[model samples]
Target: MHSINIHNKSGHDQTFEVHGWANNQNITVKAGQTSKIPAPDGSSGAIIALHEGHEGEQVEITKNGYGGNDFFDVSNIVGAGGNITAMQVGDQSTLKGDPHFMQDMNAAWHKASQDTRNKLKGFVFTNGQGKVTRIGPIKDSPELEKLVRTFANGKAYVGVGAWNGNPGNPDDNAQSSAGHGNKDILITYNDGDASPDLASPKRESRVAAFEVQRVQVAAAPPAPPANGPGIILTNKSKQECTYFFYGNYWNGNGTAGANFDKPMKNVTLAAGAKSHIPLPTTFKGRVQRGTELPATWVEFQISASNDGAAHGDISLEQGCDGAATIASTDGTNRKNGFANDVLKDAPAAACAKKPNGTKAIATTVGNWAAGPNQAAIDYLKKVVGQKKAYIVGGTGTDDVASKNKCLAVDMY
Candidate 1:
């Protein structure tokens, strides 16, 4: 005996017991309800149920509240310990029309019955306007027909294969060597001698003569930068366009690399138009000398306007300071030198270098180990200090030195 369980969205569970041969049995559940059907033990049968249809082959079990219904087959559920689950079908009305229909057809082809396939044969595809411009059977359609002809005739044919003098077997030569010296020219001949009055003309088939065309489109321009001294604007359109620039600045700590508080504005430009505006050279406050300013990169940005006009924004990193000939190409390499002067004065220009004779400033303040004995010294210092702390070490002979230092510092 096998058991089938059906669950509905209304929290109702229905179990059906199958003793044998259950075919096309219809089980109806309420709208907005989920159903579950389990396979019968030691029994093989097929069952049919109404479900909800969606964009793809997926079907949902729903009560009457939903719009459409679908049919599902469960013939292969015999001797299975698991139960088949069912749920209320959801709505798919928001999908775009063109691609969505195509996708639906593709899914239907995979899950369709023989009757469905035959019915689809009569259905025609059309553009969004709903005009039936395409014709022919699905398998023998112009698109697939062309591909088939190319595969049949080595040299590519429109409709049928050309005779290469290999007659005995339509696919092979009569005397294998008989057509060795035949010319490699495309020739079309009568399929048979039934119409002997007219000589067959040699020509490429219609299927083989079609050509595919591909067109290239231009891409849109990039967005303008966001942080710099001057207002930078960009046109988003593909054609030559102009944009307006308004005054803009970071509201917070005018640190050289900090992000601006306000967002930039952008305006559209007509083709062949250009807009120019003056940049702000100096920031509002006298940036203090001693305390380090917020690390900010410099770039340009357009100002926001009340009228809702578009503006461009640009931002640039400050140049390196302190160490002469320093490499500040990326964030990882831009470490602080010995004194605050080196890191503090680093340029706001990205990937920029400092002049020679600049002082070294320590960008990072934590203690780091260099040699094998360094870990030992670090451990000793930590243990000797009055503050509670943790000691971590890597696995290596150098770790012995760290252990010794920890013991000496009473950190062990």
Candidate 2:
């Protein structure tokens, strides 16, 4: 039998059905596709039947594949004895009924595929230390270039060692010197993990770097991670926002208690993007909150259209966008007890029980639904779910104040 291969170089996808030849079935090939089909027994060469209907349309076997609207059936007419055999077909439209004509066409398709596979492809750079430095069209980078130069004189194979699909854009339909843009540059090293752990297994023992040899031109390097020393702040709101994280000083010397407060990490969160804002690591530990001046609490000022701040002490101004009440690691019996109070494990220790030491009683003050802090509360919850959050305040008590020190509490 002969060999017929089909490659879809067009931008769109095409489907074909095989009937009366070798197999009877339909296959949809996306743009830049390739497939092969052999001729059936008792058939000289194969017949290429073509029709004008859209792909995947069910057609009669007579006028579909073997007996389509047009037929290029050349059987038992080629190099060997009269045996009805079909070789292969890349494009049935190019089939010729002549003896060697169809066979030559098949050979040409094979050659074209070979040429594509043989081209010098793209490069993927990885450090000898198992770090992927770069991928895609080759570009210059200090770290990657240095690594390449160091390995070039050593065990790294510089030329065509083997043929494989390019990893970066392996299935890209765009025609390139490499078939389907799938060729790889495998850089081996003399050193690597011989035995890796079960949880974190290694792929190859000595593969230090892997570069995909690409026929396409390289583009610019990708942007690096956002620079700074803080929690990455993301803005999912449509409008921009100016945020200020207030220091833990809710019960101290008026607003001046902000002295212990951090230098505001004011960040503008663009809609649908994230930015970084630093928070002191100290905020993760235990905290205390009571009816003292300048209670130790975490606070943040958020200003979008209006400005408001949420504290770890379950306090927020009228404009406070949102809040969340966190229970102590060990829930308490009293609704306002330090264990069961609004403040548990808070970082601040400034506020302490005074004249009415045990006189304080824990009580549930704010309802999330009726309160204005629900938005901020939901946001913190989402961030935590993403594993991007850490607990801040950890201790507090239920103290009834004529005017609540805070209207809402935001976890961030």
Best by lDDT: 2
Q: What is the lDDT of residue 171 in candidate 1?
A: 24
The per-prediction CA RMSD against the true structure, in angstroms, equals 30.4, 28.2
Task: List lDDT for all candidates, in order.
Answer: 0.21, 0.25
Name the lDDT of candidate 1. 0.21
Write one digit per residue (lDDT tens) for candidate 1, span 384-404. 211111111111111001100
- Output the lDDT of residue 154, model 2: 20
Model 2 stretches with alpha carbons more than 4 Å out: 1-229, 249-263, 279-319, 323-412
> What is the C-alpha lDDT profile of model 2 across 226-336, one tens digit per residue?
332223344433566555554322211111112211334455555556544444432211122221211223232211111111112233211122222322111121111
Give the C-alpha lDDT of model 2.
0.25
